[model samples]
Each structure stands twice: as structure tokens, then as C-alpha cells.
Target: MDEWFRSWGLLRDERQRTVFRRTDHTHLAAVCWPSCDADTLYDLARLAAVLMARDHEIDTAPPEQSISMARAFRSEVSARYGLGGGTGADPRWTPVFSELWHSLSTRRSPRFMDRCLATAPTEFLTGCLVYRRRSGNATEADELTAYFSTRRVTVAQRIDHLLAEASLGIELDDEVLGDPLMSRLLDLDVDRTILIQDILSAPRELAAGESENIVAVLSAALGCTTPRALEEATVLYENLTDTYEQALTALLGSPSGRDHDVRAFASALNDFSTGLIEWTSHSVRYTQAETSNWTKPDEIVARGR
Candidate 1:
């Protein structure tokens, strides 16, 4: 696993190396079977690399280059696994992929979604497939194929949504999983995040329309009048916005700032101090949007490209 990742140029430095070591579950029987063979371990490593690539946010090769590289990877893994036949005969096309596939495909599991959102692009897609599979009852293989078949634009949009949630630095409490106020709070935070992105990404000063949008977003999000109304919602949005601004500023002002930016943001957000607004956007358990019927899973599959 380590060797293969190194070949992919994945473990570039001590930090990445440390993360690899930390996440490596080869020794854990629950993650890897007690008698799992080296071949299976290598396959798992490849799958992990595919899933976790987005977390690193490495610039990947273009499609043709990526396809060529993936082909080479498949050949190498197949050779090692002693399934040297080409194309459909390759071992990866077999049920061997299903074993790991089932494990990676999570349902409405918030923890699993959180982990997926925190991962890199490839893994994020894998996470989405898991969601579609578990929630919509689609086959993992079909969804995986459909995902790649879709246009890069759709995939890019999906990644953007996942990245937003991953950067939000919050999670939800099970007790308030179905609370409408909590959902509204999350929706507000999400809108705030979108507005923040729009403001930061713009080249010129905020337009009158954009300015109005900000005020509207803030008005909807920040409960300006009463700190008492939804106390948890109020405080949670405050800390979340604080973290968001600091992280955004740090990224824009100094790209090479300290390594603890995310930690600092999380600390400021203080989710642990109170579990009120700990919900993340990826939590199927929580509704982070004003309207959940924008698109259906099958529709995404049909016109995803």
C-alpha cells in the first residue's frame, strides 16, 4: 500500500506520510480481515488512494492522462494479483472490487459522510455513490460507472458542495437531528458560506445586488434582534462565521500560513463547547437546505453528464 501510494506521488512529505500512517488500518481486523492477503491489502490501498485523493487536493492529470495512468495502475495491480487478462477479464472488474465497495458505500451514516466529505475528489465521488446506493438503492458498480460517465461539470459541482461542508467545521447532535430550527440554522450557515465564497471570489468590489444578497443572507442567518430566540442557533452561526472568515482570510492573505488553520477555525467555532449547531451539510440526518426537492437521485443519474 505504502509503495503503491508513493508510486502515485501521493505521500509527498512528512505531513502526508503521517496522515497515511494514521489512516492505515492494515493492522485493524475490522478494516482489514485478520487473514487478508497481501494482494487484497494492495487492492485496498489502491482503493483508498482513489478515495482519499481529493483530501490532498492534488492536481490530477487530464482525463486521457488519468485514464492512461489508471489503466497502468490496473495492469500493475492485476499482474501482482495474478489476474493478467486484459479489459473485462481484469481482476478489478471482478467481484473482488465488490468486497471493498460494500464497505466504502455508506448510507445515511453521518460519520461515513463526514469522512467522505473530508477526503479528496475521487473519494468524494465514492462517497456520493455510497449515498445514492444506500439511500436510493442503486447498485454501487452502476453508480460508479455513471459518475465517471457524467460530465466533468457535474462532478466539479458535486466536489464544490462537498468541499463547502468539509470546510464548515461543524457536526450535528443526534438529539436534535430532526429539529426544524436546527435545520433552518444550518440552511442559513450554508447560505452564508455560499455568499462568502461569492464575495471572496469576485474580482471587483461587491455589486449593489451582491451587497443586498449579503445583508439578506446575514439577516436570515444572524438573528439580529434577539440572542434569546434560538440561543443555540445564534451562537453556532456566530462561531461558524468567525471560523469561516478567519480561514478564508488566512487562505487568501497568506497561502503558506500555519498548519493549524483548520484547527484554529474549529477552535473558534467551538462545536464541542455546545452540541447545538454541530451539524454538517453532508448529514442526511440533517436538512441543510431550504428545499430538498431540487433534484432527485435518479434524475442526477439520468442527466448527470
Candidate 2:
């Protein structure tokens, strides 16, 4: 069992190296085991998690003890398929098994785990078929093939259900992930450019309104309310405008900047300016908007009348 596991480990390392270099799926079919079903894939993932846990000192078990358990697990899987003891003899089979094992061991991110769970049964069954074939047990190949055909149909149905759920926005979460500012910036469409500009010039807009309270809010959000903050934002806006003008000048005078490119630059500048305007407009609104009433409503009404 020890020797079989060591051989499997070596095969996994080699397979990972080969798969890592390939850019397309052409090699995927070639590398997958004939009997590698989805269950086998799940088992492989579990094994990997166990190994990682042991390695990270999250699991208190000895290394040799873990290895023995892994060996036993592999043997049980082989026996369940009626393929009997130890690793198969085929060179190709070893590498395929190794690759699957290595992928499970290393890539433990949520996305990778989701993929592993989804495809494990098919991979394991296919791997088992491959193992049986390599062991010269061709008689059971037809049975394995029939089983895989049904499993494939089931998998296809499940995938369709998942797709429908995704399309319905069932998977969408309000919680922000990644860098919020960068994500917001990346998500900026032409229609949302004004909002972006407003965010960028918020401090300046608030200060211009003489709203010290609003200015403080903007300062807290931006992390720095230095005069340079407003100056830098103003300069960025001016630079963007100048870039557009420069392109236009070059297009008309020297035939240096392409007209089409200049048009795009102008459009971008318009977007920036529009955003700034929207932000400043909001600041003005907030400044003018009533937040408190020191005077009674009746007294103000009588004065107005």
C-alpha cells in the first residue's frame, strides 16, 4: 500500500506539471481516467483536505498515519470497483490519477471546491473505468460506460438548474468583495460616470458649499481632507480636459492625434465633468436642505406671510 501511494504521489506531481503548461481543454480528455467518476473526485478532495490539515498542524495525526489512511482509502475505492489490489501498471493512468490528486490537494479556494464537488462523481467513475482497463479487465468496460452515460445526463440536468438559478439573481449578494473602490470604478458605465465624478470631487464640492459638517463627512470618507486633496482632484479634472484639448489641437494642426481617438478622449472628459457636476449639485442640495429648525414653524410661517 505504501509503495502504491508513493507511486500515485509521483504520478500526481508529473501530471500537474503537464496540465499547468497547457492553455486549452484538448489535453483534458486525454488526462482523465476512464473510470474516474465524480465520487472518486470527492474522495480525492477529502483526501487533499486531510493532507493539508495535517501539514498546517490543524490535524494532530502523524504524517505516516495519514499516509496509511490514504492508502487504505485508495484500496477500498479500487476494491469497490472490483479492480482489486494496488495501483494500475499503465504509465498513462498513473499520470492522470496523479494530476487529479494534485489539483485536489493544492487548489482549495471556494470556487475550486465548488467545481470539485460538482464534478467529483463523474471524474471518479471515469477514473475507475480507466483503472480497470489498465488492469486488463475489459469485460466490465461496457457496464462502466453505461453507468457513465446515465450519470452524464443527470449532471447535465443539474447544470441547467444551476444556470437558471444564477440567471434569476438568486446567487447575487449585496456584501462587497474585493477592493470596493476599484470594483466601483470598474463597474462605472457611461450613465454612472456622473456618480463616479461626484464621489471623486465630493470633498471639494462640500467645501465649496461652505458646509463644514458635510466637509467633515467627506473628509472622513476620503481619509484626508488636506487642501492638496481638493487641489489634486481639480488638477486631475483639468489634466483630463487638457488631454482632450491637446488631442483636438494635434488633430487639427499637426495630424498627430487621430480624430477618432480624439473623439473618444472628449467623450471620457465629458463623462468626468458630468460626474463632477452631479457631485457638486448633490453637495449644494445637501447644504441648502434643512436639517434643523431653531425657530417654531408658526413663527416662520407668520414672518413669511
Could you say which candidate leads in lDDT? 1
Q: What is the TM-score of each candidate against the true structure?
A: 0.24, 0.19
User: What value does the lDDT take at residue 14 in candidate 2?
Assistant: 50
Instruction: Supply the TM-score for candidate 1.
Output: 0.24
Checking candidate 1 for backbone clashes, the offending pairs are 54-120, 54-121, 55-119, 55-120, 151-305, 171-278, 171-279, 172-278, 172-279
125-208 per-residue lDDT for model 2 (tens digits): 344333333233322212323433333332222222222222221221223113343133222222123223334445544656
RMSD of 1: 19.3
Q: Residue 67 lDDT in model 2? A: 40
Candidate 1 Cα outliers beyond 4 Å, as residue runs: 1-8, 11-171, 204-305
Best by TM-score, which number? 1
